[model samples]
Target chain A: MTFKKFWVMAYRDLLRNRRRTVITFVAIALGLTLVIFMNGLITGMLDGMLRDTIRLDTGHIQIRAESYEVVKTSLLWRDLIDNADELAARAAAMPEVAAVSPILWASGVLGTASESTSVRVSGIDPASALFDPIREGLRAGEFLSGNGRGQILIGQRLADELGVGVGDRINLAVGNPDGVPQEGQFTIVGLINTGFPGIDNANVFLSLAQAQSITGSGNRASTVRIMLHDINDTDKVVAALQTPGLTVMGWRQLNEFIMTTMETGTAVYSILYAIIFLVVAVIIANTLLMAVFERTREIGILAALGMKGRQIMTMFLFEATILGLIGSLFGIILGAIVVYYFSINGIYFGDLGDVAGSLAFGTSLYTTLVPANLFLMAFWMLVVIVTVSLYPAWYAARLEPIEALHAL
Target chain B: MAAIELEHATKIYTIGEVETRALDGVSLTIEEGEFTALVGPSGSGKTTMLQLMGCLDKPNSGTVKINGQDVTRLNANQRADLRREKIGFIFQFFALVPVLSAYENVELPLLLNGVGAKERKERATALLEAVGLADRMDHRPDQMSGGEQQRVAIARALAPRPLLVLADEPTANLDTANGEQAMDIMARLNKETGTAFIFATHDQRVVAYAQRIVKMRDGRLVDGNANGSAK
Candidate 1:
């Protein structure tokens, strides 16, 4: 009951200065809104990057020869998986596996008579569902066939850069498994525009059989890339595919750089959030201090009426709690609306796509709504507001009744 | 037993390098049920004397007793507890909490004392009716006239059933009629409740309502009977 009266007093006191109260509320709301929006945008951008990398490049998990080194593009027979088809079939039999394909990776150069550029060549089973995104992205020509000879599928960006089109012939030179340079003339049977600059800028795909024949690595593959029904099932599938001479890796291991960057980004954004909260906290503290100054005589009356110092402080803290709760509620609503809009129609980064091509970031970035983050932000905002209000509350509580009553 | 006792209490105020004796070796006693006034000129220490007696401040040299318990040695919180349980105050400014209605202002002390809800409402309503503010119970201080606010303050002071009520120039801001109306209400309530009243004022009309008047000059009691007419 005493608490009820204190709450009543606090609530009415806020109403006494409606304009100031509204202004303080706006400060807290805007501060929290900005934090939530930034959190959503950053989380979306990073998660989108990771998703794109996994979809277009890493898959959920990969099984490769134990001696294989991806950076070296080692085409040595000893470094390649000899029973690649058998391993792929084994993985495809698992219920957790969404798609399984034996892929051959090689470093090569594509020439169009006027220009030549380095590219990563992917030899894939065109029938595998794991390449569905690439198949769906076929811009001008049909997708590759399993038995097509001397045919390749290149990103529209790569074709545009090389001044080539579908059905155009391009010369590809690669090192065979015997360390001999092999050259072949292949037709760009299809062009793909996946909207991912990393893939569009430097990747070319061909049938796995033809790739093995050209590289003189018969029945061999660089790795068996497996896509899971759910990314969480990567560990289960990997455990089921643990063979003696193979190394199984999950997407997290393949994309360790992105994961590390995300962790570091979280720490940096936490400091940014702290700075934002501090700014809001100072505004709240200043507002309560002004209220304390204005209510000096009233405080004296309350003290003379037998309210202890701590009780007086509790009243002010209650005021802050009310302000914080309502303000943050509005902030969460506004922030969620903004984030949802951006999540649907992403924010466009036209040139940044090309700049961040190596990171597999798309041209447009979307937001992800994490309910926990929104609530956490609101909770911390309330905590900061109440914590900072302590100084003004303490000042009011320590006032001497006689001196305060004498104040004008 | 005396409602309040001050024995050779002295209070000094210091500012910068200067010192002023606000109260000097003053001793006084007021028994329960006495209506008294401390009359003096400006800076003559009437407010200081009332502050010491009210437990708002501790004297620099002497002891103040409220309900025969030594209050000068008590800490701030202890003094607040004593004030809440044993005393009440009315200010010259009609110090009703501006945000609260008259009824709420009167009920604030009772709420602080943790009185039950039903009893709190009954006592607050009865007191407001007694002060002739039964219709003005819903009016905030800003919405009411000075006289009405003062009457509200009076009701609030007596709401706690305190041993004494201290009023400092209770009518300083009211007109002649409002002042007399406030004084009549306070006099009637004092007689009816049998609660001690100590007011620090220079108004002759207000002093006339006091059953015993103690005069002060330069922080010293001028009356030969330091105990006042209560003796």
Candidate 2:
């Protein structure tokens, strides 16, 4: 039969039972829509978390000593980056490098009149772009103006625990030049809230020079955090900055847990899509089977008219293709609308509170509509729908002309 | 050459252990352009003979031939190809594809034969006009009366200009007037196109219109001009 004739016949057969066809199409459309929306939401959440983490904590790449250990017990200056000014200038000179900030990290305790808490003291250049989050998050007072004037910036959670606010005096104790414990009195100049539970509860910022002075490490830092023009250039920049005694790490390598979770979430989402499409397949298969039974006499008539078995099968498959195309078209439109709305407004999860924690860093969830994923899902749905219709098509093809004509 | 020849054809229907012979050692030959009717009571095997002749069913222990070619050895697809090119069928209930218009139903066989668009259009239009459905060409089966639907089926059967048409109870559902009208169209088309037609039916009205009658009783041909004289 001519291709046009086959399609015409297939379309008319679907119209024989309009209600069932419409219902099956709706099932496929709604299933695809759910898949698209879920993928968009999860993708947006991961993107947001990665961007926030890169911007706030890990930069795009960090260069540290080869033997650097995160859990350092002693205040040894041997593992610190030497000639930090020269290395920072070298990193900043690369075309792909955006900004690099040298930081001296020390384990210290902050004591006030009421409470004392052990904190991770991050000494930063308050003027550099690396401190942009702290600058943006200033709740009260002013940020540190110069290198070492006895000024400090504390997170809101830490301030709350210490019962101190801006302008309150907090005593910081660390190792001095003699490798002996020494105390330095500093006034809290700023109280900042980054909203990330992990950062807000543990980090206290000071100037790099002041931290070096307090830890007796003159002109040295633990690491030089390098930001790139684009996060995608992380590996290239890391390869370029591979020095003799320095270990360069990308943000993904530093945050292994987040990357693992993102991969797991993606795999789980794919399985979810498979299950949803499987349900769609069952619905389409059942509808076509019922159609085959209802059209037994018609199939017999076609057979008697000298239609081949493969032609009969092709007719039914064509019906499924039409239904799948229409349904997936509508599904993409619907999913785009929903995802666009959520992308603009975001879903508020005030009840989630700290559930955002370090991963999401916020209570409101947004969605991103990835067009390629939507297109792929629609294509897969079409393939699956056509495949699922094969069983019923085969049944129709195998119908005996004489027996089917005699079917009551 | 005969349009169709069935030699010692036998068909048995087995229902779990009870076997009944539907056609028993029946031999028949239908010439081209002959308007023949196979007339009998129920279970007389007239329909089975028609099915065998139409290449729709295979005989158990006999050879069936179409236009001097033995078709008993033809596979299902080859048989279907032969049918498409050499035979047509009109069912009892007018079995029109209900979704298709009268024109499309007539054009279906031509389409199946891979006829080109221009020739297919010309042939289908001419046949629909011949069947006197030129004005009702755009109407579907549900929109047409019983006689009109049967007339469309007649045009469809003749679209490919096959050598033979097997119509099983072609007018069983129509009233007397409609039945006579349908039979008149078939007879006229047979005479005009020289396409042989065989009718399997118990309707006397249909039998009276045939140029020759073959009668069967209890799965065997008993008497008729095609065999011998009336028993």
Candidate 3:
């Protein structure tokens, strides 16, 4: 039979069972909507965290000491990018390279005449830093701008422990860039609380000139933080720049565990998504099968009336495909509805005390729309529905007309 | 030329573990432009004989020829092609697809033969008109009377221009008056168009329209050593 004719027959058959087809469509739509909406939430939360982390802590890429590259936790810092000023200028001139800031960073003790706390302080050129003016975190006195004399910025949590505020005399003690224990006193300039316990409690800010003065170093910083338009192109830019004693570390290397966790979570999400989709597939399959069985005599008549077995199969397949199409279309709409609802009024995870602590990122959770996920769910569900449709088609085609007619 | 010719035709059905003979070594030939009837009591293989000629069932052993094509030796695809190209069937229940309109019912066989939409429409409209259903072309089977549905079935049987039409008690569902009207229509079509008809029926009233009647008993030809004809 011609395609037009076959499709008409198939369409007619489908129209006869309007209610059942609608139910099947709704089933697939609901399943796909769940995955799309949930995936959107995770994507949103992850994007928020990435922006916070990237905007403040990791500047897309960090050019560090080779020693820090090998044993990242090692305190053996490097002040040894031989041509730091020249290389930073060269990289900054590139279009893709957004910013290059030299950061004198180390972990040490923050103290005063009153109290003390552990702190992670970075001494950076305030004007050159891309974002998160470490100065913002110093919720206290001024940033001791351009003063060759020492200055300090402390975290809010660290400030509470130290019993101090801006203009208070605080002694900053750190092992010098050369491993020599160094001590200096600076007026507290700021106190910061960024909602991240890691940053809010332990971070401090200072000027590179002041850090160098306190540590007795000249024209040297611990790391050159490189920000780029494309984070994944670290290798291309890193290879382009030849610097002595400098090691290039992209965000992937800097946050290896987090990225890996993202990958594993994605894989798990796919499996779960597939399971839910299969449930909908079963729903569709069961609906089509029951339909085939119920229309056995009708199918038999069609088959006996010079309708090819293949055409019969195509007829049912067309029916299933139509059901899937309607389902997927509704799924996109339903997914949009749920996405809009959750986007405006976020889902709450109330009082997640210990649970918050366990999360690798932070406590805030929100769904987001990921196109890959939507496409994946949509394509996979369609395939499942169509694949499930085949068995019913084959079974329907196999039904003997005489027996099927006799069935009634 | 003959319409349907069968040589040594036999049919066996498996009922559980037992094989029962529905038609045992029966051979019959129906001629073109003739109104022939196979009359027998229930379970006497009258319907089986009609189904065989209609290509709705395959015989256990036989050379069944329709317009001289050896249909018994053909495959499933070929059988469907043969049925589409040459054979037409009318069921006892009128067998109008309930979802379709009167016009679509007649258009089915043409559709099977892959007739173009315009031509199919024109031809089906003409056929429905011939069956006196022109005004009721859009009416569904349930909306039409029993006589109207049967007439639509008659129009469908002629849609493909098949040389032969096999009807299994085509009037069984109609009342006496409708049945008479249906028989007149079938007889008129047979005479005017010269399309052969093979009817299997137990109704004695149906036998009156037939020019030749063959009687069967116990699945065997009961000719009694003569060419039996109740003309």
Candidate 4:
């Protein structure tokens, strides 16, 4: 028979039992919507965490001494970049570079008269745009000067825990490059609240010059963090800043743990998506099988009218395709709307954010809509729907003409 | 050449441990343009005989030919092709595809035969008109009366202009008036198209319209020659 006639017959057959058809449509739509929404939420959470980490901790790229070990928080002059100013100047000249700052990292203890805690101290160029989040997060007091002495900024959460506020005199001790502890009394110049618990709970900041002088590392900083105008330009800037003695690292390499976690999470979600698709497929297959049972005599008539078994199979598949196409279309629209809404107005998790503090998860989670993922999901749903329908179609096709005609 | 020839055809049915011979050494010949009836009571295998003649089933032993081509060795697809090209069928149920309208039902066989669009439309329209269903062409099977649906079935059977039409019962569900009306339309169409028809029925009114009668008892022909026709 002509393909057009097959489609007409299939469509009309679906309309014959409108309620069942509609139910099947809803099943497929809901199944796809659930998956799409889940993917959107997960995408948003991962992307958000990565963005926050890049903003508050790592920049788009970091240039450090070839032998520098971040885990060790090393203060040896050999482990620090001595030409930080020159590297920062070269990177600042690049149009792709949004901001460049020389930062010296040290492991230190900050002690008030009543309380003490180990903290990661970041010595930063106070005027650099890379510190914009910290400046914007200044909850109290004033920001430090580029040439400030014996001054530091502590997180609001840390300040709350220590019962110390701005202008509170605190004793800070750090290991100098010579391996002896150097102690200095510093006044807390500002209180910052960046909303990222990883940063706000355990970090203190000071001017680059003060940190360098206290550490006895002459004119040396730990690393030059560079933020790009577009993160996609990280590789290009990294290539531009390729110096023989310094190692340039892009965001992907710097955030290897998060990338690995995302990959593992995707593998787990794939199993979930397959289960969802399989359930939808089973619903489709069951509906078509019931249709075959109900239309046995009609199938006999078609067979007697010279329609081959394969043609019969094709007709039922057409029915499935019609339902799938319309259902998936509706599903994609509904899913996009939901994802878009969540992307704008995020879902609040409150203290749940601190559970993943090390990953820089924020206080609220937003969804991200990836159009290609939506289409890919729809495509796979269609395939699964059609594939699962083969059994019912085959059953209908294999019905003996005389025997089917005998069926009531 | 004969339109159909069945020689020593035997079909057996095996239900669990029980075996029954549905058709036993039934040999018959039907010439082109002949209207014949295979009349028998229930369990006489009249329907099975018609099924074999229509290529809807294969004989266990013996050869059945359609348009002088041996179809016993043909595969399922080849048999379907042959049936599409050469045979048509009508059932007691007024077996119109319920989802399709009367016009599409009539056009179905033609579509299967891959008839061109213009000719398919013309022939389907003309056949529906011939069957007196031209005005009801847009109606689905449920919308049409039994007689009307049977007429649509008749139109569908002849759409491909097959060499023969094999009908099983055909009028068992119709009222007396509708039954006679359906038979009258079939008789007229049979004469107009010059297509041979073989109907299996116990209805006297249906049998009265046939030109030849082949009566069956159990699985064997009770009268007529080896050709199973009283000429």
Q: What does candidate 4's lDDT look like per residue over A298-373, in tens digits?
A: 8888988889999999999999999999999988998898899999998888777656554343567899999999
How high a TM-score does candidate 2 get?
Answer: 0.89
lDDT of 3 at A160: 77
- Against the true structure, what is each candidate's TM-score? 0.90, 0.89, 0.84, 0.92
Model 1: CA > 4 A from native? A65-79, A90-97, A107-119, A135-145, A151-204, A229-248, A350-362
Fraction of native Cα contacts reproduced by each candidate: 0.94, 0.67, 0.42, 0.88
lDDT of candidate 1? 0.90
C-alpha local distance difference test of each model: 0.90, 0.86, 0.76, 0.90
Q: Considering the two chains of model 4, state its CAPRI-style docking category.
A: medium
**TM value for model 4:** 0.92
TM-score of every candidate's chain A: 0.89, 0.87, 0.81, 0.91
RMSD (CA, Å), candidate 4 to true, equals 2.8
TM-score of chain B of 3: 0.94
Task: Please give, for residues A16-35, the per-residue lDDT of candidate 3 as tens digits.
Answer: 77888777777889988987
How close to the true structure is residue B75 of candidate 2, measured as C-alpha lDDT? 81
- Candidate 3 error regions (>4 Å): A61-79, A82-100, A107-121, A125-193, A197-207, A210-217, A226-257, A351-364, A370-376, B224-231
lDDT of 4: 0.90
- DockQ for model 2 equals 0.62
